[model samples]
Each structure stands twice: as C-alpha cells, then as structure tokens.
Target: MLLELHVWGPAFSLPSIDAQCLATMTYFSLVLPKDAWVLVASSDPSVSPTNELPALRSGATWVSRFRNIVDYLRQYSGGEWDLDRDLTGGERADNIAFSSFVESRGQSLVDLSLYVSSQNYWDKTSPAYGAILQWPNQWILPPKIHAQAKLRTEHLGLSSLDLEAIREQKDREHSAAVAAGKIPKTLIRNPRETVSTLLSKTSQQNQFRLEALTAEFFEPLESLLGHQPYFLSPDRPTTLDCLALAYLSLADIPDLPFSWLRDAMRSKAPGLTAYTDRMRRHHLGLEVKVIDALSATSTSSTSSPSLPWQAPERASFATLGKTLYDTLADSTPILKHIRLNNRLREAALAPHSGLSGKESKAVSAYALARKHDLYLSIGSVVVSLAALVGYMAHIGLVGFSLAEQEVPSGTDPDPDADIDAVVDAGQVGDFLSML
Candidate 1:
C-alpha cells in the first residue's frame, strides 16, 4: 500500500497550514522517493486514531506526530529512511537539543504571531482556515485552535497582543462610565479607544518583551547556522533542519496583519530567514491549492512536478457522523465534561511502558466513563428517534392504528369507520380521550 500522509490543508501559499505538518512533509520529501508517499491535505484530524494531523498510514498501521513518524520510518525501513543516518554522535546530540529548543521557543513565537494576536487571527489566519474547511468544520476548528493557542501562550504574559481581551476590558470600562453617567449611551465603543491608541498604550513594554523573546530563540539559531547551508552541515540536512524549516517558514512566510515575528526574523536573524526561503523554494512546492490537489487524487496526473501531493484520504460516513455527535457533545455542558474525561483517559492510557498503580486505576476509571458515554449516546439517539416519530404522527405526517377488534365474528366491519382519518387540532383531545 502507498504511504499516505494526512495533514491540515494549505494556507498562506504553503503546502500545509500547520507548522508540524509542514515539517513532516519536508522530512518525507527529503528522505523518501517521490513515489514512496503521497500528500493529502485532508485538514481533518478525525481520520487519525490519535486525532492529530501529519498522521502517516502504511497499510493498516497508523503513526501520528512528527517525531513518531520519523521514528517509525527509521525502524520500519531499518535506517534507510533515517534523515540523520550520516550524522556523528555529537551531531546527533546537537540535533536533539536544537529540535527541542525550536519546538518550545519557536513554537511560542509562531503561536503569538498567528493565533494570540487577535487582529492577525481574525483578519488573516482564521479566514485562511475557513477557506480550506467545509461548513461546520470551518466554524469549529479555527476557534478551537485559537483557544488552544491562548492556553499555550498564557504564561508568556504578553496580554497586549490579545486585542480581543483588551477590547472586552474597554467594553467593561465603557459600561462603568455609562452607569456613572459620565458618558453618553449613544457611544457604544469607547470614543478614545482605537487600535492605534491601544497599541500605543502598550507598545513600548510589550515590544521590548516580544523582541527579547524572539532574540532568545533566533540569536542561538543564527549563531549555529552562521556560514552553513544547513543547520548541522554545509551540504547535508537532518531532522533538525526539518524542524527549523517548519517553525521559520510559518513565522517568515505568512503575510499576517500584525507581523512582529516576521519583522523580528528579518532584522535579527536574516541568515535563518534566508535558509527558510531557500529550503522552501527547493523542497516544498511553491503554492498549494487544496481543492485542486484533492481533485488530482482521482486522476493519474500529478499535482506538483516534484512532490507527490494528493488529496487526503476521505473520511468514512461513520467518522463524519461521529464527528457531528462529538461536535454536539462539545456544545453541550454535561456532554462536554464527558468528552473531557475521555480525552483525559486517553492521555492517561497513551504511555504503555510505565504505569504506576494509581495511573492504572485512573485508566480503568476512564474506560468506565467511556462506556457510560456510549450508553448515554445510544439512549439519546433512541429517545430522539422516539420523539421524532411521535411528533410526526401528531402532525399527521405519520399515522398509527391498532388492529380492528374481532368485529367480523359478530358483524361486518363498518365502512363508515374512517380508521385513516387525520386528527385535527380541535379533535386531538377527544382522540386522546377515546384512546
């Protein structure tokens, strides 16, 4: 079977919208032959058992995440697919260190630029996702991603970047002013509060903090890259290169409304920026149109001359139905708790090698909760169906009647008895009374 790589759909002219997905694509392009794998911009994480993108499927086995995919390829192909096969022991150590550093520091910077910044998210990033996704998914995924990004960068203490929060604060202030009879009710927004004013209020301190964070990440990478074509060597690229390319490309390439990260990359770390541009041009194809790529999958023709880009595997109807149910559950307060419990259970059960007694019991409890959720779902469906049938019958769209009493033994059935009679509003109570 062909190796299929499922990832988030394209945005900002990149093959994959997500940084991790792009890194996984770059790694596969470098290591595997063009025919060895196909790219599918499914943009649907539900396809993966782990519910994440950049998931790789080889026949029946499925692997998820960038590192896990790399590890699987190495072991499955017996080092033939290892990107760092030629690296020395010391170089490998450097690779591990830098990859972790990029994930932690670089990831934060990207999150801030793309998702935490309300202007960029609403004006550019969120809309980009909407363009790739179908109806309800377009509605669901972007906000979920934004919420996660907020949680991830909460500790950064750069609340100035979150204009939405600032706006809410301003609204509260405006409310207080109105209550105190200080401002006219006709003035909805605070007359003095504009985007420029908001930024001006916090620019100096926030810019300093933001620039310092960028320098902390970029200065090290700039020093390491120095005069080399790649991260570790002048000629060869490794897993570290893939990781660096993912983060930097996302930061540098996208033309967001607020581009603090991009501006910092250009001024402070020109070398890394250049590297990202060069690698992107050479390895990743110039532009990715999700619909065209997906359409290409049905034909024998190629979408790109260099990379094997195809549509992602289509989700089954069952999967779609399950997603709808899950979406409903998430929207509901009680079911949302069950969904959270299921996720918590999965996290608890994911690590198979070492399980303390307490962890094992937690896993069991989670399993029980999952079972309860299943029963609840079934019960809900049954009740919903019953309600639907009853409503249809009441509205005269459906009809039900008991078998006629054994009147034939005593006399012929009455032709005047209209058992098929429709119930009218006035007679509904009488019909119930007769029953």
Candidate 2:
C-alpha cells in the first residue's frame, strides 16, 4: 500500500530527501511485506490543499508514528507512546514542537532531482527498507471524500481569529441589511469557512512544483518499502502517523502555517483524536502567526527555479539544504539519492547511465589510489626479503670457497656442509692457516 504525500518546497528553500531518510525508508519499504501502504501527505503552496493531513487523515488508516516506529525497533523496545494517561499542558505541547526538529528541521526542504533517484534505487531492495521511491506508478492519495473539518475558533466565549471578529460583526450587518431589505456584499465572513471549494491550484506549473516536494520525501520512502504507498495499511506497517507527523511537524513555516492540522484531532478524525491527544501531550502541536515576507519566499534561485514555486528562489532553501547536488559530490550515491530525490538527479547518478564528468573522475581517482597503495606495499615487502636472502647466500659461499683453498685444494667443498664446518672454514683462514 502506497500513501502519497504532496510536498511543497519551503517558502525559503528547496526540500530534500537525504540518505538518512532514504536509507531509513529504503530499509523500511524494502523490508516490509508486499501489501504495505505508502501515503505522501501532499501539499501545494497554500493554507489548504486537498491532500493536507486534515483532509487526508479522514481516509488514512491508523498507524501511530510514535508507537509503530518504536515497535519497528521491537528488540530495542521503546515502549508505547505516552498518549492519554500522562503528559498534559505545556510539556506535552512542547514534545510535539521538538519532534519537528527530530523529523523535518534537520533535512533539506526541497529536492532538485527526480530522474536520477528513480533510476538508481530502481530495482534495489532491502529487508528493513519498507518503501522505495525508485519505482514508477508510485501511489498517491485522492482527496478526502465528504470531509469538512470545523473548529469553533472561539476561546472561552471570546473570539480567537481576526476572521472570527469579522464573522460576529457580520451578524450585526445582516440585521441592519434585513431592516433595509438590501443584500450585504460581505455577507459571508470568510469563504474558507463557508465554501467547500478546494484551495488547490489548477495550474500545471503549480502541480509540478507540488509533485517535486512530494516526490522528494515520498520517493525515498517508496524506495525503502520497495513498493508504492497503498494509501491504506492493515497493520502498523504503513500508518497515518507519517501523515499526521508531516503537517504537524512543518507548521513552523509562518507563511504556510497549518493550524488546522494542528487542531485537527477529534475535530477531524474523531477515531484518531486520542492519537492527536497523544500527539498533543507529546509536545506535538502547531500555531500560526505572520512572519516577515522578506524572510519567507518559497523558491530561492538567482532567477526563477526550473519550475514555479511559492518560495522565493532555489537559493534561499539552499542556505540550509544538505541534499543539493553541489553538496553530494563528496557524498555517497545513496546520500545523493536521498538528498534530492528527483528522478532527474537519480538518473544522472546511475552507473554507466548518468555518470557526470566530475563524479566519474572522482571514482577513478579513488580506485587508482586504492590499487596503487596495495601494489606498493606488496612489491616492497617481496623485494626486501629477496635481497636479504641473496646477501646471506653470497656470504656463506664466499666463506666456503676460502676454507677449501685453506684445505690444500684437494677436497671438494660439500654443498651440504654442516654449520660447524662453515664456521671452521672461517677459523682456518683467520688462525689455523698460519699453522
């Protein structure tokens, strides 16, 4: 089972799928049973995308990231997640915030390659790698069916969002409009609150951008499983924890905050509310606030990206991106594959297929040095031993020849003479010859 997540490059950087996540998911997908699910909780550059966690979770199968992942290390036994019984208030909330660091903050936000990744891990498989993205026809989750998540947004009889204040004033305006019998222009406070239209973009360019982000993380995950995500899972093998975790994890992006998913516990997936409650108690929660627009651009290239994005340029994310092509020259191909999980990049790295000029040279240099060192060590040892043996034989023969001369030149020097006879020959030359 493959569960596809839509990925969006960060407002300031490109996202990456690095070796660790790749190796992890690679080991995971490759190792799991054939029927596992893979879900890429997808997102475009907007506050609400159809594949966002709040919507996707409605159909997502229950798999606790904390519990299931820990169980994967069953021998190590991390124990069940601290969900309901303990951890409340700020402490539990803080755990969620910190886990984001454990999940999203450390890796690159976007990937630059797709082809290269697809080709490299194409046929490879592993026992522990539950998902592998190198395969095509990768699975994706359709939009939620008849799903509408609602939150009162009113705190203790007080208005929460500024939109909430506007909604309250609308009632006053509606009353006035009724008295005068005139239709109000701003009758609905927020269309998002009342309308059921999807906030997804219809442009192909936007779609390409979203696919890139989704693929960055998803491909590596798929590679690990050795299959596409099922969008559903029977056991803890493939769970919605990955779905719940992604949005809740990356909610720090101010421009693209996902408070809806943060508050989408019983409010959204009532069955998983306890899980969200567990997530909440574990310091996993989200909040939204305005950030500096200058600090938060989607793509950050010098010009525009190869594709369109809500981010500033390709370079902004590059400031913190570890999976960029330039960074992987010194890294392993697995690292390269994981860093930017685009098919193009992965294809470029394939042996005899995509080998770049510099990478080929680097491989050649490394091989040459290894071979040279081995030969030099073996040759030097053989020559030194051969010279020592030759020198010892020469000294023994020269001494025997002198002793035979001292023995009146009548007897032949025996080739098998004893050690004592050779020593006596030296003595005859030194002392007995005078006698």
Candidate 3:
C-alpha cells in the first residue's frame, strides 16, 4: 500500500520549510520508500484529524502531529531510521533536552521571523499564503491567519513591547529629569536627545533577551557540534538535525528581518551551518550551488536563475479561467470515456480479475456503476452550465432594458461624462430615481 503525507503546500519556498513540514520531510526522506510514498499539498487543515498539517497516512491508519507521526513511522518502518536506537542513557537525556529546547525556543524565533516581524510577515509570509489560496480565501484567509499569529506572539510576550512607546517613555524620563534639575552626567555630556542611542539601548536589551532564550538550545548544540558533522552521532543525521535544519535554512530567505538568529548560529556556533548544509544535500538533494546561492551573502547576479525552492508566480485570473476550462473538460463525454476505459483496463488486470462467480459479477457491477457515474457527472455539468448561461443572459437583457429606459431617445450624452463624472454630477441618482 502506498503512503501519503499530507502537508501544507509550498508558497514561498520548497518542501515548505515550515518547521513541522521540513521535519516530516526529513524523516520520510531518510527511511520511507520514496517510490511508494506520495506527498499531497493540502490547503485545508480540516482534512487532518487534528486540523493541522504534517499528517501521515499509511494504508488506513492516519497519524497527525510531528512527534506522533515520527513515532508511528518508527514502528511502521520497524525502527530503520530511529535515531534513538543506538543512543546511550546520557545521550538520550541530552537528545530529549536538546529537542525540547530547540522545539520551544527555536520555534518561537521562527514564528517571530515569519509572523511577528512586520517586514517579514507582510512582505514575504502573507503574500506566500495568498498565493496558495483561491479567490475570496486568498483575500480573506491571510488577515485571519496573521491575526492568529499575532495572538500567539502576544501569548509569547514578545508582542507586548512597543518600541515607539518605549522611546516616548524614555523621552518623558529625560524631560522629568531636566525639569527636576537632576540631569545625569551622561545626559550632560551628550547634551542632545539621540533617539538612535535610546533605540540602540532598547534593541540591545531585546537582543540580549533573545540570545538568553536561544542560548538554552544553541549553546548545547554548538558544544556538541564541536567537531562532528551530526548532532549526537558521528555519521547518521537525527531528529534534532531535522528540527535545526528546518529553521536554519530560513537564513537563506531573502529579506528575512530576523536573520540575526541565523547570523548568530553561523558566527558563534561551530559546524552548525555545515551540518544543516549537509542535511539539506543528503535529504533534499538540493544542489550545493543552489544552496550557496540562497545563503545570506550571495548577490543576485551570482545566484542561480531558477531554483526548485522558489514558488511559481501567483495564480492570476487567467489561471482561474484555465482551471474552469479544465474542470469543464473533465466532465466532457470524450474525457469521461477515456477515463472510464482506463479504469476498466485497471479493473481487468486487478488481482481478483480472474475470479469466477460472485467476485466477477461484483467487478462487472462496479465497472457498470462507474460508467453510469461518468455519464451522470457529464449530464449534471451540462445542466449547471445551461442554467448559469440562461441566468447570465436574463441578467444581461434586464440591464440592457434598464439602460434604454434610463437614457431618453433625443439625449446626446456628453462623451466627457464618463461613469465617474456622471456619478459626480448626480445623474446616476436621477437615472435610478427615474427607474
């Protein structure tokens, strides 16, 4: 039986680079039969039991969430790719601590970069979502999604601080200090109100807070990654690597505001960048040239012209029209016949095709039902199209009659009086009143 991994579709980049999606992709890439597994890019989270993505389907069994899916796959694959298999007791403890720290702290940073940061969220992340969704959903879903992210960020206490508000408070403090004739020696020396200096101080404080949170994960990671390629083991990549690589790869994303995290890792952490690069190559098969091109330092001229990670242009009205055309074609008699014939051929070659008596009759009945369904689908489509066309035509005729009644026969309307001009002249209201 084929395996299906239903994940959030790519919008901004390939394999989604969504933390959970990347982790799932990494794990499956290592162990699962690539030929037998199919990746379905799902826009609807409701399809999953838990209403979240990175869901796995093995035969009839459905598994949701990254941890659950990993556990399920471990048992399903008979422990083939289990990283914990060879770990000592101490190593297991380290693994647990590291994984927890990375999942929590690292994920928060990822969330901040992709959702909380105004530049990253609005310009890069929101548009990425809009590209994947259909009309109305494209318009509606992004704001709702962004609001939810903001709420989550607020829960994290990261969204609570307002830099502008902080600056204003600092200004008030300086003013009060001057009014009381208690100006600090530092203020006297500077004598000027430097917003930049104030902002820098606030920014440094925030940076320190971020570093403290991330150090819980990265400090251990950097120490462990001293000389080795992988995190715990020497050769095999583990779950920790999957988790790390997912966020680390975001360093390459152009115009990412929270790239300080990636910069910190690269500059401070030993072998971390190399480990993620190796993992990217090993699991994703992304070319080194492409990977390097996507890195923070690479210039536009030096970067590759195209990469698989880059999403195609967002679907336009023309694409929607094409989709409607294809949908109509699917219900046409010729396409239906072709599809039915293919199904019949597959049914004939099926395992129980040669079976006699009841089995054979059931197969024949199934094929007959399928043929009927094809015709039924086509008929329904035709009825729908006719109804739609008739309704539109009726609306058109009504609009035309209304226009004729609104305009007098002798009236030579000024060419300069366009719709906007006419509306501005109150002529539109008069015409409506006449109607």
Candidate 4:
C-alpha cells in the first residue's frame, strides 16, 4: 500500500507552514523512495484521528505527530527505515535530548517571529495562511493559529511583540479613563505610525533580551554542527538533523517584516545557516501543486495530474459547522476543564499503529470514551433544558395544559371550559396582575 503523508499546505515557498510538518516532509523525502509514499496537502487537521497535522497513513492505520510517526515507521518497516539505526547508544541519547531542546527553545522563537510580532504576522504570516485556506477557512484558521502561537509563548513575557496584547492594553487604558470620568483623546495614526509605535515599545533592554534568547537557542546547535554537513553524524543525516532543519528553516527561510530571528541566525550562526540551506537544497526543498479537492477526480484535459502536493480538502457544510463548534468550544471558559481532560485522555491513549492489537484497543477505547462524553454532554443539555422549561411553567412564564376534570352526567365537554381550566391552572390571573 502506498503511504500517505497529510500535512498543512505549502506556504512561504516551503513544503509546510508548520515546523513539525516540514520536518516530517524532510524525513519521508530522505528515507522513503518518491514512489513509495505520496504527500497530501490535506491541511485540515480535522481529517486526522488525533486532530493534528503531519499525519502518516499506511493501509488502514493512521499515525500523527512527528515523533509518533518516526516510532511507528521504525516498527512498521522493522528498523529498515530507522534514521538513527546506525547511531551509537550515546548518539541516540543526544538525538533525544537535542530534539527536545530544539522544540522547547525553537518553538518560542518561531512563535515570536511569525505570530507574536504584529507587523510580521499581518504582513507575511496571516497572508500565507489565507493563501492556502479556502473560503471561510481563510478567515478562521489564520487567527486561530495566531491565537495558539500567542498562547504557547505567553510565558516568555514578550507581550510587546504581541498584537492582541497591545490592543488589550490600549483598551484597558481607555476603559480606565472612562471609569475616571475623564474624556480620553483619540489619536488617529497612519499605518506607518502604528508600526513605528509597535517597534518603539521594544526597548533596548528588550532587544538585548531577544538577542540573548536567539543566541542561547542557536549557538549550541552551531557549535555541535561545526565543520559537519549534519548534526551528530558526519556520514549521514539523523533525527537530530530533521529537528534542527525544522526549526532552523522556519527561522531562516521567511522574509518577515521583523527579521530579528533571521538576522541573528545569519550573523551569529553562519554555520547553522549554511547547514539549513544545504539540507533544504538537498532534502527539505519541495515543489507542490495545490489542486482543488473537489475537482481532484475530474478527467478534464486542462487538469494536471500529480502527487505530493494538492489543495486542502474543501470543508463540507457539516465540517464547517463542526469547525465553528470546536472553535466556540475552545473559546468558552466553562469548557476549559472538559477540553483539558479530553486532551489528557488522548495523551494517555496515544496510538501505536504499528502494533495491531494495541492500536485497535487504543483507538477503540478513545472512540468509545469520546462517544460517552458526547452522550453525557447531550444528556446534560437535555436535562438542563427540561429544568428550565419546568421552572418557566411554574413561574407562569409559559402557558401549559392541566389534567382534565370529571364531566357530570356524561354531558358534552365544553371547549371553552377546558380553556378556562387551563387558564386557571396556569395562573393567568396572577400573571396578568403582575404584568
């Protein structure tokens, strides 16, 4: 069976907008023959069982996330495709340590550059998302992604780079003025002025801090990769190389409005920059044609037939509604606990698709748990609605029928009498008096 790799569509002239997706793309390009596995720009995470990108599908089994995919493929091919199979035990240990370190530090830097910086996000990142996403998704996905990036990097204390945070701060200032009964003066600023203001807030201290952060993240990798084509191995690429490539490419490749991250890499870590460029030229570089999912099967003469890169799956009406619902669910403050639990459950029940028995059990248990959660949620809503209706009826907020009265001598029941009885039982007189 031909393996399928589903990922976010191409953006910024790269294979994927997401860092992990790009890494997975490079991994497959290195290990699997071109004909063995095809890439699909499914983009929509809803397609994946785990609701994540960089998903790998083999036969009926689906694996998601880059690390899980690596492990699954290792078992699936029985170590034939293991990139680290040649590594010594110590080298394998370094692979795990450095990959984690890269993810921890590199994510914040990427998030800062792409999503936190207002100008960069608006000018470059958002548009990239808009280009790949279709219809309503173009509007929804970009902001959602931006919000997620902001959330991930919230602990870094870099609110000055955040667009939403700046707005919120201004709003708070305005509200404080209003609360104090002082009329706040509104200042009209042009786009250039706005951009300048945002930049101006980045104090010299903040600039130094940013420089320190970037150096801390990149310098070690640069030293490790000195005079070597790849990290940890002089002979061939390994998982560490993939991790480094994923983070470095994202930092170096994009031409953003705020080029601090890219500039730092170029100036401070020339070796790392060269390594990224080399790997990209050799393996990470990919050309993908985005085709409409709806028209993928058309036999038109004008249509181009290809693999690896296709348009994202056009969301159906149901899919759109569900996406909207999930967005609302995420945004709702009350559902925070529920969402957290669901995520924890998924983490515990992570799929191991290479093992049939375990994979089946895990998937089945997850599905069953999700089903029960949905049923419980629906039942709670029904119960709450019933309670609300009952309360309304008791308070005479709504009209309702009462039990029939016995008729004397089997006389014909008067419709008007029934109405009167209902009115009396419903407390119409009291309700009207209150009104």
Candidate 5:
C-alpha cells in the first residue's frame, strides 16, 4: 500500500523548513522507498485528523506529530531505519529525554523566532504563507496563523516555569500578602489587571528566556555531536539527527529576521552546524555552501547531482512580487542598489526583448504603474510639508494675538493664565480662517 504524507506547501522562494515538514521529509528520505509514498503540500487543514500539517496516511491508518508518525513508521516498516536498534538501555532513555527536550524547549525557540519576532514573521514568514494562498485566503489565513502561533508561543512561557508557573507564583504572593495584612482583601488585583501585568512583565522576560534557553539547548547537543559525523552514533543517522537537522537548517537560512539563535549556534556550536550541513547534503541531496568557522571561507560540496524533492519552478505574479520585495528590502546597500537597477533594466528591455506579447504588455504596464506611483508619492510628501508649514504659521499668529490680548500696553503678563486654552482657541481660529 502507498503512503500519503500531507505537509504545508513551500513558499518564501525556499523549500519547506517548517520543523514538522522537515521531520517528515527526513523520515521519508531515510526509510521509505522513493516511489512508495506520495507527498502532498497544501494549506487545507481538513486532510489531517488534528488539523495540522505533516500528517501521514498509510492505508486506513492516520498518524500526526513527528514522534508519533516515526513510531508508527517504525512498527509498519519493521524497524528498517530504527536508530534504537543499536542503543543500550541507558542510551534509549537518554534519546527519549533528548527528543522531548528538543520538541518542547527547542521547538519553542524556533516558533518564537519565526512567528513572535515581528521582523521575521511579517516581512518573511507571513508573506511566505500569503504567497501559497489564493486571493481571499491570502488576505485571511496569514493573520490567523500568525495569531495562533503567537498565542502558542506566549503560553509556552520564557523559562521552565511557563505561564502556569508564573500565575501560580502570583497566587502564592497574593495569599502571603493577605495573610500578612499588607493590604485589604478587597484591594486584590482583579483578573483584568492581573492579565495585563502578566503580559507586560512576560514581554521582556520572554525574550531573555528565549536567549538563555537557546544557548542551553545547543550546548549539550554540540558536545554530543563533537568529533562524530552524527549525534550519538558514528555510522548511521538517527531520529535525533532528523530533529536537530530540521532546526539547524532553518536557523542557518540567510536573511532570517532573528539571527541571535543562529549566531549563537555558529559561534558556540560550530560542530552542530557542520553536522547539520553534512546531513542536509547526504540525506536531502542538495548542494549547500558550508562556511568554515576557522578559515572564514565557504566550501561547496555536492551530495547528488539530481535532487528528488526539489520544488518545481514557480513563475507566478506572487513569486515575482515576493522576489522584488525581498530584493528591495536587502540590508546590504550595494546589493539593493544593483538589484533595483537590474530590475529597471529588465523592465526597459522587456518590450524590445523576445518576450511573448502578453508578457511584454504586463511588464510595460507594471513599469508605468510603478513610475506613476513614485510621482504620486513625491507629490503627496510635498503637499504634506506645505500643510505642516501653514499650520505652524497659523500657530505662531495665534500666539502673537494671545500675547497682545494679555498685555495690550506690553506690561508684565499674568503667569497663571491658561496658555493651553489660549492655544486651543487660536487653533480654532486658524481652522475657521482656513474654511
């Protein structure tokens, strides 16, 4: 029987690096025959029992979640790629613990970076989702997904204590305060104020917690991966390798909004980065440019000439728009300038070039529209500036009129007079004059 794996579609001009998607890809690469299973990428949630991506269906059996899917596969495939075959009693226990840690703590960091970090989520991640969706769905789904991810991240908490722990701590403090007669019971903070305070406090604390946990998570993994090509095992890859590689590849992505986690891994856990790069090439069969930390130069290696899982060529308007947006938003000054110039040159050459009549017309129209937009933007700015100047002049005239009314003979003025009210009256006069 053929297996069917449903995952979130690729976007952002990149392959799917979503943790679960990566895990699914990793599992498929390892155990299943290349043609045995079909992979489906879509945004629809109805396909999965849990309403999540990376769900697997083999015959009538349905499995969701990376670990659960892997366990089921292990049973179904008869332990063909099971890493636990060689593990000792202690090693098996350690593997389970490590997997749980990565799923909870490590996964939280990835979620925070991709969704909670404003720059990454808005500029890159959300737009990626929008690209995969149709017009009305694009308008609606991205925000909903973003909101859901953020709420999940918030609930996960910054430290080990989490939101529940913090709430419990607050309750304990309130009880102590009441016992000590520090304040009246009636003066206890209401639910609204309690929630407000918790949000305010956790906002900053969450960032600090992410930083600390990110470092803490990688330290042990790096040590374990040292000198060995894979974590725990020397020859064959394991489930832990799949989970670690999923996250490491994501963090290493160029131009990600949150770089602190990536930078930490690069600086403090170079071995982990190297290990992931090797796995990505070996299993995924893509040529990744790996930068040597000591030499500070990139070394390119080809795992396979042809990749089975490569995404098909995308040539839609959404793809073009996203490409332009990313190019324009490039932080590097020279690259941005060059990309913009190249785009303009392409637009100019399109009508004369060997493009189809429809393509030429589309390109020409886009260029003209963009030019008009630039002109309108400049005009709007000029008009805004003129209005601002006129308003400032009106304010000055009102101030002068108020001064004259206060001291007609230019004597000492009353210091206690409400100057703010006078200013408001002047503003009213200015508005009336304008009318």
Candidate 6:
C-alpha cells in the first residue's frame, strides 16, 4: 500500500526520550515500505530534528498540525493503537526514522508550546471534545497519564473547521491547515516563560491533572515494588519500564536535584537498586548517580544544601508525574527524541545529495545550519556547565565557540580508504530491532 504516514508533531521527539515512541518508531522504520509519504508535523519545519535533513529528499513531508494528522490517521487506522499491526519492512524503517526523532512526551518540563498552542486548539473543538469523551461514561476510567488530552480537545474546537459549515465554506480559515502537513508558526520557548512565570501560568486544572496522574497512575505502580530504592527488576526489564526514566534523565538540572522516591529504590526484597544501575548502563547509554544526592549533599557540603527537593522517602510522599506523555505518545516523534539522548551521539556525517560540486555554492548555507545544530546540542552542554569550572571564553558559558569547527576524527572517510565500497548501514538498523 502507498502509505500516507502523517506525523502531527505537536510535541515532537526533540523534547524528550519516550519509550513507546522509541519502540514504535524502531519497529516502523525497520519494517515499513519505501516511497511512503512520511508527513512530519513540526511547529517549525526549517529546524530539522532528525539530523539527516537531507533536503527532504524524495520521501518525507514535514508538517505542523494535530488535527491534520488525526485526519490522516483516520485515512489509515483509527484509535486504540493500531499503528504497528501489520507493516511491511520499508514501512517499518520509515516509522523508525520518524520515531527516532520524537521527543519524550513524559517529562519535557518546560514544554511551553503545549500551553501556547492551546490558544489555537481550544478555539476550534465545538460540540465539545469533552462531550465526545463523556459519551461513553463506562470508558471514563481515570486516564493513564495526565489525561489532559480530553480537556485540550476544546482547544481544537470545531470553530476552525466550522463542522456545521465545513462542507460549504470553501474559504474558511480553519486550523485544519495544520493537518495539511505544513509547518505552522509556533514559539519554541515563550520568552515570557521563566521557571517562575511558567509555574504561575500553570492552571489549577493542570495541577489537579498532574496530582491525579501522580497519585493514581504512577504511585500505585511504584507502590508495587514496595519501598525499594530502584526501579529495575532482576536482570531483565519489564514492559512497563520508562516510567521514571525521565525523572532521572532530566535530573541533570544541577540547581534542581533529583527527587524520585528513595525508599523504593533502596528496598532489597524485590531488589531494584542493582537493576536501576544496570539499566542506566544499558538503555540510557549514560552514567547515572545511584547514591542518594541528598546523603551526598549533606556529607560533602558543610554548607547546608539549598534546595528543598530531597527524595520522597526522606519526607512526605510528594508526587510529580507527567500528564503530557499520553497526549504525545506515537503522535510526535521529534519531541520524543529530544526528551531522550537518543538523538545525541557522535556518528560519521553523511554528505547531503543537495551538494552539487566539490565546493558547491550551498556550502555557506549548509555550514550555517551545521553551526546552529552544534549550538543547540553541543553548545548546550557547555551552557549547562557552570563557571565553577570556567576554563575558557565567550557568552554565558561560551568558552569553546570555535572548537566546533573541527572535523570529527575517526569518522573521516579518507582515513580508511580500504573499507569504502559497501553501503553504510547506520544505527537505524540496530535501533529498529530493539523496538
């Protein structure tokens, strides 16, 4: 089948690392057919998340609207996760490529667009999406994650589509243009959205949504393992893994120490501690601090630790779970990739087919784009590192600006002329099978 694989990247993979997105994208990329129209909905299309922008080549269509994708998906499969049912090999590969770019929906803490885009979605959903959700009262079981998808539909009100007049009004200005697979204008980080400003903007409903999700969806699951200190079980991982993954992954915000429950991790019965350590080594592909930062804090600093965020077992069981994950899931791949470091790694760069000559006129344009990518990811590493170890020069944490110009070593093709004839298969293959 000629596939119209539409991606409504409302909250793309670039925002965080997500498990389902990882799994689904992997399976799809490895198995889906070629020549599929992979429509990627990004608030900004010019900003490529996959790193392999490759000038859109011949297969992909980047876009930016949630409803547009809903309409597209309606053309293929319907609700309740029918995405990976029976896809071919090429179809699976494209899905993996798309998935590899999704941002983790779970804990992309500063996702301001989720708030700003509502200024558009709620203006459209008439007859009320809430009404549709309530039609089946028996299905009113508390939703898995934040469950904000229900209320947010009001944001996608039918006013835009003019459901009553959609068929007749040819010149209507509906938000469904987003569904057409074109990038819409969206602000990445609302300049006004400081940590304090964002906290203030959080509606009471958002608080309840988060509270309910934490108390109901996440806590009980954490409760299952008793008051242990870690989440991993034995030598293998469960299908239900990735729940607390972000809580640790994003804990790199030094000013804000990690606050996951410690007792559950420390418990020896089910034995979570060792498993967590091992998973950090395996899945995350990064080093994790297993020892409680709180204990380390008190012992290391004669100066009392400034922040109030200790592990849950240290005091009252204060819960902080994600409401965004359920809404994004398979929908936005780029944002999911951003949430996880799956997008981060050193690899041999591929020459874009866009290059016409040994030194095409487009070199300047391409260099600028490469510079932007370096700053966004690699530059962030320096910016996040405090001046407590300031060794060089420039902006906020801007010591190594020119250092990025260096070509990556061990990856230069000329260095190894002997093994150059075969088609190079990248991480795409290995990443797909894992899903």
Best by TM-score: 1
Candidate 3: which stretches are off by over 4 Å? Answer: 160-205, 251-254, 285-435
Q: Using Cα atoms with residue i matched to residue i, what is each candidate's TM-score against the true structure? A: 0.76, 0.20, 0.55, 0.75, 0.54, 0.23
TM match of model 1 to true structure = 0.76
Ranking by lDDT: 1, 4, 5, 3, 2, 6
Return whichever of 1 and 5 wins on lDDT: 1
lDDT of 3 by residue, 1-435 (tens): 777777655533444646787677777776666575766555445455444577777776677767778877677769875756788888888877888777776777777667766556766777776655566456555665666656766665555233444556667787877778897655653244455464455456678766665566567777877888788888777777777777666543334544555666667664777777666666654432222212323344432222222222344677567545644664697775756555664545443234556775677677777777777988887986676556544545435445656988789864653554444446434433543
Clashing pairs in 1: 40-312
Model 4 lDDT tens row, 1-435: 789898887666566788999888888877876778877777788777778888988988888888889998898889988899999999989999999999899999999999998889999988878766766678777877888988999888887887567777777876787777677445432222365676877644379889889989999998889898888989999988888898899899888878989999999999999888777767755333233332344343322233344334567999889888887887886575567556655655656533466665676577568767876987887886786667557754454233243346667765776565565656645544443
Cα misplacement distance, residue 404 of candidate 5 (Å):
64
Candidate 4 TM-score over all chains jointly: 0.75
Give one digit per residue, the lDDT tens place, for model 1 in 160-192: 788778888878887888899887667655555
RMSD each, Å: 10.3, 29.9, 16.1, 7.9, 19.1, 27.8
| CA lDDT, every model vs. true structure | 0.80, 0.31, 0.61, 0.76, 0.63, 0.30
Reference-based TM-score, model 5 = 0.54
Evaluated against the true structure, the overall lDDT of model 1 is: 0.80
Shift of residue 10 alpha carbon in model 1, Å = 1.0
Decide which is better by lDDT, 2 or 4.
4
Q: Write the per-residue lDDT of candidate 5 for residues 1-435, one digit (tens) a residue.
A: 877776665543223547777767776777777777765554444355454577777787667667767777777878875656788788778777887777776677777667666556766787767655544446655766766666777665543223444666767887788889997877877352454455456656665765677788888888777898777678877777778878777776535644666776788788888887677776654542111111123233443322233222223677556534553565466455544544654644432243577776677667667666666777887887777667656656546556758775757765545585577667866665764
Range of the 10 consecutive residues with the lowest summed lDDT in candidate 3: 303-312
How do all the candidates rank in terms of TM-score, highest first?
Answer: 1, 4, 3, 5, 6, 2
The global Cα lDDT (0 to 1) of model 2 is: 0.31
CA error at residue 393 for candidate 5, angstroms: 67
